[model samples]
Target: MIDVYLFSGFLGSGKTTLLKHMIGQVKAQGLKPAVFMNELGQTNFDSDSVDDGVPLKELLDGCICCSGSEKSEAQIQTLLAEETFDVLMIETTGAAHPVEALDAIFSPLFAERLNFKGIITVADSKRWLSRDELSPQIRSLFLEQIRHADLILANKMDLLTEGEQAKTIFELQSLNPAAQIIQTVHSKVPFKQLEKTTAKKSDDVVKAPVAKLNLDTRVLRFEAGVKRERFEEWLRTLPDTVYRIKGYVPLEGDKYPHAFQYAYGMAQWLPEYMKMQPQIVVIGEGLEGVELP
Candidate 1:
C-alpha cells in the first residue's frame, strides 16, 4: 500500500509551496512519489512547478466540493493505475473541505492500495489572525480545515517574530491540542516528524457553519502580454464580485508569461524568466468578461 498524506489549507495558505518541500524530502528519503492535483478552474501553477521526473495527475474541472467524491476518487484511481510509486501527496485547494476529500479516498477501489498516513493542514499565521475582516465563507473553510486535520503544520512562521510565533503555536495547540503543531517557513521541515500521527484524537470535528460566499470562479486561459500596466489596470477594473483569481499568463514575447495568483485579498507576482511560452490559468469571481491582452 502506498502511503498517502493529504495536504489541506485555504487559498494562499501555501499548499502548493508545502507540496514542493514535502516532495523534496520524499526524494531525499529515497521514496518515489506520485502527486495528484485538483487544480480546478483557472489555476496553472501545479504542472510547471514540479520537476519532470515525478509523475503528475490533475483534475481541473472545478472545486472538489462541486465534483463530488466518486468522480474525484476516479481521477486518483486513474493516476494510481497509470504509475506506481512509493507514496502519494494530495494537495487540495484552500477552499476545499479536507474531510470530504479524505472520505472520498475511502472508496473500495482506492482504500485497499492506500494507507492514509495523516492529514496535514498548513495554517496561514498572519492571515488567519486577521480572518475576522475576511468574508464569513472564507473564514469558515480555514477553521474547518484546522478542525479536521490529524496534524497541523503552521507554515510561514518566518513572517512572525519570536514572541508572535510562540503565541501562534500556543493558540494553535489550544485550538486542537491533539494535533502536532510544527512551524516553518515555506513548509520546510523534517518529514519524519511531520508525517507521524499516532495520537488518539476523536473522529468528530466541530464544524463551523459556512456562509453562502458568492464564489466568483472562472477559467482564464489567455496568451497575451498587452502591456503589464494595461493588464494590471484591467485587473483592478474588475467587478467587486470578483473574490479570488489564480492562473498563468505568457507575457508577450517574454519567455514565460506572468502568473496571477490571489488569496485572502493578497496577490503575488510569479514571473517565469525561462524560455517557455506562457500557457497559464486565471480564476476569479468578477472576471467573467475580462480578457487578457
Candidate 2:
C-alpha cells in the first residue's frame, strides 16, 4: 500500500515549507513522491514551489472539506492512475477544517488502497498566541485543526521568545494531548520523524461540520513595477481582517520580481532570481472593497 500524508494548517502557517522539505527527503530516500495541493484562490501560486518532474495535482478556488471534496477525490484518483509514486502528500487549504478534510479523503472508493500515515499540522507560534483576536468561528476552526493533528509542528519558533515558545507548546499540548509536538523554524523537521507518525484511530470522535469558513480572496495584478516604499505604505493601511497575502510583485529597480508574503500584520519580501508573474493574492474577511497599490 502507498503511504499518504495529510497536511493541515491555518493561513500562513508554513505547511508548504514543510511539504517541500518532505518531498526532498522522500526523493533522497530513493522513493517517488506525489502532491495534491488545495488552494482557496482561483489562481495557484504555491504550486510553483513543487520541484520539477514530481507528480502534482491542484484543486483551486475552494477548500477540500466542502465544495471541493468531490473534486479532490477525482483528482486523487487521476493522480494514482497516472503516477508511479510511492508516497502521496495532500496539502489542504489553510482554512480547511481537519475532520472534514479527512472525511473527504477517506472515501471508500480508494481508502483500502492506501496507508493513511497521519495529519501533520503546522501551527504558527505567533498566531496561536494571538488566536483570541480572531473571529469566534476562525478561532474554533484553528483549535479544531490542532485537536485532530497526529503530529503538531509548532512552526515559526524563531519569531517567538523563549517564554512564548513554551506557552505555545503548552497550549497545543492542552488542546491535543495525544499528538506529538515539535518546535521548528521555517517548519523544518526530520523526515524520519514524520515517517514514524501514525494516525490515531478513533471512530468515536465527532467530526467537524461540513462547511467552509467565510473568507474572501482578491487577486491583484500589477501591470507596472511598483515602488517598494509605496507598496509598504499600502500594506500599512490594511485592516486587521486581512489574514494572509502572498504572491510575486515586480519592484522598481529590480531585475526580477520578489516573492511577498504578509500574515498577521507582518510583511516579508524575498528577492527572486527568475522572472515571475506580478500578481498578489490577498485572503481575508470583507476584502471586496480593499484598496491596493
Please report the candidate that would top TM-score against the real structure.
2
Per-candidate count of clashing residue pairs (backbone under 3 Å): 12, 0
Model 1: per-residue Cα lDDT over 192-229, one tens digit each: 87557652333565556666545555555564555666
- The local distance difference test score of each candidate is 0.71, 0.89
TM-score of 1: 0.83
Error of 1 at 179 (Å): 1.0
Instruction: Report the lDDT tens digits of candidate 2 across residue range 1-293.
Output: 89999999999999988999999999999999999999999988889889999999999998898889999999998898888889999999888987778765687888888899999999988999999998887888888899899999999999999999888899899999999999999998999998999898867456665344688999999898989999999998998889999999999989999999898788889889998998999998889678666
| Winner by lDDT | 2
TM-score for candidate 2, please give it.
0.96
Worst 10-residue lDDT window, candidate 2: 204-213
Query: Please, what is the TM-score per model?
Result: 0.83, 0.96
Candidate 2 segments whose C-alpha is farther than 4 A from its true place: 208-212
